[model samples]
Target: MATFEEQLKALESVVERLERGDLPLEEALKLFEQGVGLSDGCKKELEAAEGRVQVLLQNRNGTRRVEDLDLEA
Candidate 1:
């Protein structure tokens, strides 16, 4: 399985190719499908990481809590 970074990089490359409009219809469709899968995978990984962070930030009383992450930075 590809790492999250690898998947994201592939998705970016797919987008760049699609944007260039040089690929045939069939090839473009295939790349689009792959891009969709890559996007979903990236999202799932990010959510899992966020969950881990939330768990790590839990109070010592054993209660889980989540604080908003400043992803803009």
Candidate 2:
């Protein structure tokens, strides 16, 4: 399995290629599909990492405290 960074890089490459507007319809479609899969994988990896960070933050000071992160603030 590719690492998150690798998947992200691949997705970027796919976007760049698609933006060139030179690929045949079939080829572009294939790349689009691959890009979608890569994007989903990257998202899952990021969510998992965020969960880990939250766990660490909550466990600081040898006590387990649960809190929702307010990213919108």
Candidate 3:
């Protein structure tokens, strides 16, 4: 199984390719499908992480705050 990080990296690459706007229609469609799948995978992973953290807060008295992990800044 691809890890969350790997899927995220693939998604970034897919976006970059689309932004370049050089791909043919068929290629673009394939990449678009891949991008969608990767996006969905990333969302699922994030939701799972959030649920785990909520459980942590309830059972372990952990703080729920999250730090920014964005790379765009």
- What are the RMSD figures for all models against the true structure? 1.6, 4.2, 4.2
1-73 in candidate 3: lDDT tens per residue?
Answer: 7999999999999999999999999999999999999999999999998777666555345557555445697
Instruction: For model 2, give the RMSD to the true fold.
Output: 4.2
Worst 10 residues of 3 by lDDT: 59-68
CA lDDT, candidate 2, residue 49: 85
Alpha-carbon lDDT of model 2 = 0.92
For residues 12-52, could you state the per-residue lDDT of candidate 1 as single tens digits? 99999999999999999999999999999999999999989
Model 2, span 1-73: residue lDDT tens: 9999999999999999999999999999999999999999999998998878777877547776657778899
For all predicted structures, in order, the TM-scores are 0.86, 0.79, 0.79
**Which candidate comes out best when scored by lDDT?**
1
lDDT of each: 0.96, 0.92, 0.89
lDDT of 3: 0.89
Residue 51, candidate 1: C-alpha displacement in angstroms: 0.8
